[model samples]
Target: MSALWRRSDLVRATGGSAHGAWQDVSGVVIDSRAAGPGDLFVALHGPNHDAHAFVGQALAAGAAAALVDRADDHPSLAGLPVDAALLRVADTLKGLERIGVAARARSRARIAAVTGSVGKTSTKEALRHVLAARAATHASAASHNNHWGVPLSLARLPAAARYGVFELGMNHAGEIAALVATVRPHVALITTIAPAHLAFLGSIEAIADAKAEIFDGLEPGGVAVLPADSPQFERLRARAAAAGATIVTFGRSATADCRLLHAVSDLSGSDLSVRLHGRMIDLRIGTPGEHGIANALAVLATVEALGADPVQAGRSLAEVAPAAGRGARVPIRLAGGEALLIDDSYNANPVSMAAGLSVLGRASGRKIAVLGDMLELGPEADRMHAGLLEPIDRQDVDLVFTVGRHMQALHDALDAGRRGGHTASSDKMVPLLREMLRPGDTILVKGSLGSRMKVVVEALTDGEAAGVRPQAN
Candidate 1:
């Protein structure tokens, strides 16, 4: 592999001493399992385990070099008989930050940073797919958008990249500010604000402020893409204006630059039309949800902000499928026929829960919801969980199954005819849910990451024995 970093660059970027022969690597990895012959392994210390313990494993897996902070009593390489390099620094994470900063500085790529209570990963994936169609684009993989995730993505950025996309996430205040500063995005997008991390941040207003922190890292005269329909729109707009960012809005509102004209949906996807700047562009997305339309608008606005063809970006939407756990759909074979399993068990909040309910409302057949608790809701957890009662009834869902303590509120509030079952734990609902599902039933499983609701999604989609009982309308 050609040098991803020069000797001088590594020294200047990390301010660390190089003790062995060094070579440029093609890839960067933190896990020993992922390290290969031409990879740079960064040893990061965490709560569960220390990467220092895996340095030998990384080297054995054919890593070219390992970056470490602990050198004294570090395993000696004298008898290993392998040609490996060891770069020592005072602090491993800070050293990584330096490398990320260096990576951004050396590259001329136009950067876009995204943050939101929901849809951060989905929007990031959409941007990656849309942008890659027009340039040498790089983006955070999966949901890698936290403290280490942001820097690790930046550090992995290739110098030849033409565009870089990053997702920033936080459960507390001041987190997005620090991450956006590192990204220094030319275009920053806030999908929307909601009461996701209420346990840590306190109020929805505080969450809005935390999400607004993404503007602090915007490049001068850069673009701020926002959701025009969001209740926190004015707040985000004010913050963006204060940061000297040009504002562009996208939503179903009249003021939005990228305005959604209409959306027609089916099980496969949605055919949506959005007015970009002044022209109306229609696109079909392979995901099923109104949130998909909203996220696509943000992508369109962002693509235009970066001087890319919004038309091409819109075209790429045809290929944009939902990411696993976020909204990936699976088919389960049954004794009579088959059931459609919608896997949205990744994460959830009140707003996302309503959105998922709306998706269920539009299903072709019987609608069922297997909901788990929304965690980190703090004191209003019960009230927030109970708030779903209205949306559930409005959706006309045939049956509802619930898990977790907080969900008990909604289960109790639901009409007895609509109540499928309620359980203290998700595991106990597996057999009950398995027995309840019928052919043509479209089931949506969703909850916060802490809820572990994906287990039910797994049980259904893994083709378990379909000793099923039919349900009456």
Candidate 2:
């Protein structure tokens, strides 16, 4: 951005010409709402909308430059500054890819990438907490771990960052490996690959194979942090070994480099006693899930691998908190009294659902589970949902509610005597939920993002916290 970006650079990156005047861009953007001065807005086409339609709005919103698929037909062609750049490409995603790779090349930080069926976002948050207490650390914002997200996060990595964390995610095979190939990580953490994304990967073993691909991007002598209790530990261990990287284990196991000696998960927060090497330290996760405790151990190990103080790193985890719609607790007012709400409505698979349910089970008072369908299960969707009946029954949940097309299967699978009635929409669920509510009831809201279960959580709770859209400020 110091000098005018050469037309040749954009041309070479996307094989497109600077048919319009070239300008030096100071920043890159996707959303027209957040566009700023001297920004280059890339108009990405999506299922429901075309970003090309908003080029004028972006330009009006102080965007100095823009990129689109069709250069000649763009409406803002006449308003350009003589030096303004018009970047045209075959695909806007591909053009963003070029920008991202170029930005990564400018950075000198020690990049660490994490992936697993669960806990990727939480572990990444923990990484930022521990690493930032000592150095200038930049990490993926939320769960920015997909195709476009990976490149976009990599592009946003500041060149002056001392440490970096990238959370890579995939629902299908070859996706993680493709991403890993781009942001080469100094330490790759596989929290644990459980039965997730089964529709695309076929089985848990296949998911393990895909999760092991994190090692594909490791630099020589890089570390692979594995959970000792994970059923797939040996598989990942062999894979990391074959990739010529060392392994740092984390779990309750004695052999682990970073292990949890005691974890007390409660409504306030989790009090964790962790063991690193031969030393033991006390730490607390500012969230209320056992899964959060496990994730903190991974962050603790990552800090040690990065040569930071383990005790200080562990203690710093208190600064980390859950994102909205991911185990974020809210208290709701019922007609009779109040109930605790655990809104984990962002995304769900078997592992995260079970973890959330377990955390809710441990809370005080009567338990109410309002669950929805978990998508992308392929063939095992029904059995998987049905498999929760025993756990719910054993956990002594006092009431049950459900929504979505597939959740009805789980609703019917429950015992007739224990059934509290079911509704396929959270709006329609008001009556039964009202009847079931009590002073000390604890309600857990969970489902895949597509199920819109967060709406159900919103209905129960007062809007004191506003909404879940995150901001950079």
For model 1, residues 1-473, the per-residue Cα lDDT tens digits are 66677666777899888766766677778888999987889999888978887888888787878888845555643344344578778888999899999999888999999999889999999999999989899999778898899889999899999999999999999999999999999999999888898999999989999999998998888999999999999988999999999999999999899999999987678999889999889999887777888899999999999889999999998999987788888888777888888888999999999888888888878899999999999999999999998888888898999999999999999989899999988788899987788889999899988899978877777767366766655
Write the residue-wise lDDT of candidate 2 on 91-163 in tens digits: 8998888777766676788888999988898889888878888999989887889988888787667667889
Query: Between which residue pairs do clashes occur in model 1?
Result: none
CA lDDT, every prediction?
0.88, 0.79
**Clash number for candidate 1:** 0
In model 1, state the lDDT of residue 311: 91
Residue 441 C-alpha lDDT in model 2: 72
lDDT of 2 at 85: 52
Model 1 lowest lDDT segment of ten = 75-84
The window of 10 residues in a row where model 2 has the poorest summed lDDT is 464-473
